[model samples]
Target: MEEKPFLGLRTVIYAAPDLSATKAWYAKALAIEPYFDEPFYVGFNVGGYELGLIPDASIVEGSTVSYWGVADIDKVIQRFLNLGASIHTDIQDVGDGIKTASIKDPFGNVVGLIENPHFSL
Candidate 1:
C-alpha cells in the first residue's frame, strides 16, 4: 500500500484577540476545560481532536473554518446560537446525507459543524 499522506485533522487554531474571554467562551461552549493554558495559547481536547486558541492582536479576517463532527447539526447549531454564536451558514444538506453549518463565534472566529452518516469514530 502506498504511504498514507493524510492521517486526519489534528488541530485547529483560532486567533483570539482577547485570550481570556475566548478561552472562557470555548470552555463553556464545549463543556470541557482546556488541558493547556498560558498567556500564548490554550488547547482543548475535543473528542480526540485539538482545538487551540492563540493570542494575536493583528489577526486578519476570514480564518480557516474547521467543521467539528456532531450527531445532530440542528441541536448543536441551536446550542451554539444560544451561547451567542451568530450563524455564518444555515444548516443545509451538502450532498449524500451530509449536513453542514457554520457560525461566527463570539470572538469573531468561524465555527463549523457537520453531520455525516458515513463517518464514524
Candidate 2:
C-alpha cells in the first residue's frame, strides 16, 4: 500500500458565548455571509476553508489557534487590526522566509496569519 499526503486545512472551530453576535461580527470582518447556520454551529466558507463558530457557555480566552494564509503579512495584520482585532502576536519571521502573526478577535478567538513566499496553491 502507498501512503498519501494529508489533505489541507478544512475547518477551524472557535467557541462563542453568543453565537449569533459572533457570527454577525465575523460576517462583517470577513465580508462574507455564512453558508451554514444552526442553533449549535455557524460556518463560513472562506475561500474554500471553513471557519466555524460553535456555542460554548464555558468559552475561555485564547483556547485555540488556527493560522490563515496571507499574501502580505503586514498588510493583512493591518486589515485585521482595522476590523477591531487586537494583536495577540506581532508579525515576525519564523524562518525560511516565512512570516506569521496572530490576533484576538472581539469574541476572544485567536486568528493567526501566515505569509510564506515558498507556499502556493
lDDT of 2 at 95: 97
Give candidate 1's TM-score.
0.91
Q: Which candidate leads the pack in TM-score?
A: 1
lDDT of each: 0.90, 0.85
Worst 10 contiguous positions by lDDT, candidate 1: 56-65
> In candidate 1, which residue pairs clash?
none
Measured with C-alpha atoms, the lDDT of residue 102 in candidate 2 is 92
Residues 1-121 of candidate 2 have per-residue lDDT tens digits of 8777877799988887888889988998788999999998899998889988988745444556778988888987777788788999988898999999998888778899999999877
lDDT of 1: 0.90
Deviating ranges (above 4 Å) for candidate 1: 57-62
Each candidate structure's count of clashing pairs = 0, 0
